[model samples]
Target: MTRIPTLFFATAALFALIGMAWGIQMSASQDHALSPAHGHLNLIGFVAMAVFGGYYALNPLAAASRLAMVHYALTLAAVIVLVPGIVMALRGTGEALAKGGSVLALLSMALFLVAVLRHARGLMR
Candidate 1:
């Protein structure tokens, strides 16, 4: 409904498309080795983002804050890095990317908690 929610939904849709494509590719090739990474991409990228968007749409105050934008950025970074990072880790590459992305994801969720406490409180009234 609002700008932030719209952005989030758009991002979620994109991630869903990517995840679906990856899934189809895997199925066609009969190689499920990267399924875990694919699952994370859909869960964190699509589902988490859509849930955030819904929350923001319902709580405009939370969506309006600068912290909301920060949350979105952190989430975007997490999905972007984490998927590839997991792939690398599974392939026996260095784990720096996965670790960094995991931290980013944690920070994103932490900021989201702050948003709920700080801005979404009005919903309780």
Candidate 2:
């Protein structure tokens, strides 16, 4: 019943591990140029996703809905693209992916708000 929550945690853990490794790598190389990207990876990919999972676990009614899955997908996509986007932008590649990923992140937050609002409505029933 908590498939989404479990998925979120699993993905978050992976992101956290990657972020940690990235941090260590940067430290070893004495290059903090990509710290911004690493920070986002940990904050968005690990912390935010883990928080989303906790929220879903607390509100299974919302978790059971399609919106939850969509939220997961969108959030995951945001993390996937956004981190790389930041890196590419930092490398002077382009701003396209960063812009797109920012939009996805915004949309994901909106969906999360919708889920929270809907859950509140259900609670009043």
Off by over 4 Å in 2: none
Each prediction's RMSD to truth: 0.8, 1.0
lDDT of 1 by residue, 34-90 (tens): 998999999999999999999899988889888888889899999999999999998
For this target, which candidate reaches the highest lDDT against the unseen true structure?
2
RMSD of 2: 1.0
Instruction: Work out the TM-score per prediction.
Output: 0.97, 0.96
Off by over 4 Å in 1: none
Q: Candidate 2's residue-wise lDDT over 1-125, tens digit each?
A: 49999999999999999999999999999999989889989998999899999999988999999999999999999999999999999999998888988899899889999999989987888
Q: Residue pairs in steric clash, candidate 1? A: none
Candidate 2 lDDT score at position 93: 99
lDDT values, one for every candidate = 0.91, 0.93
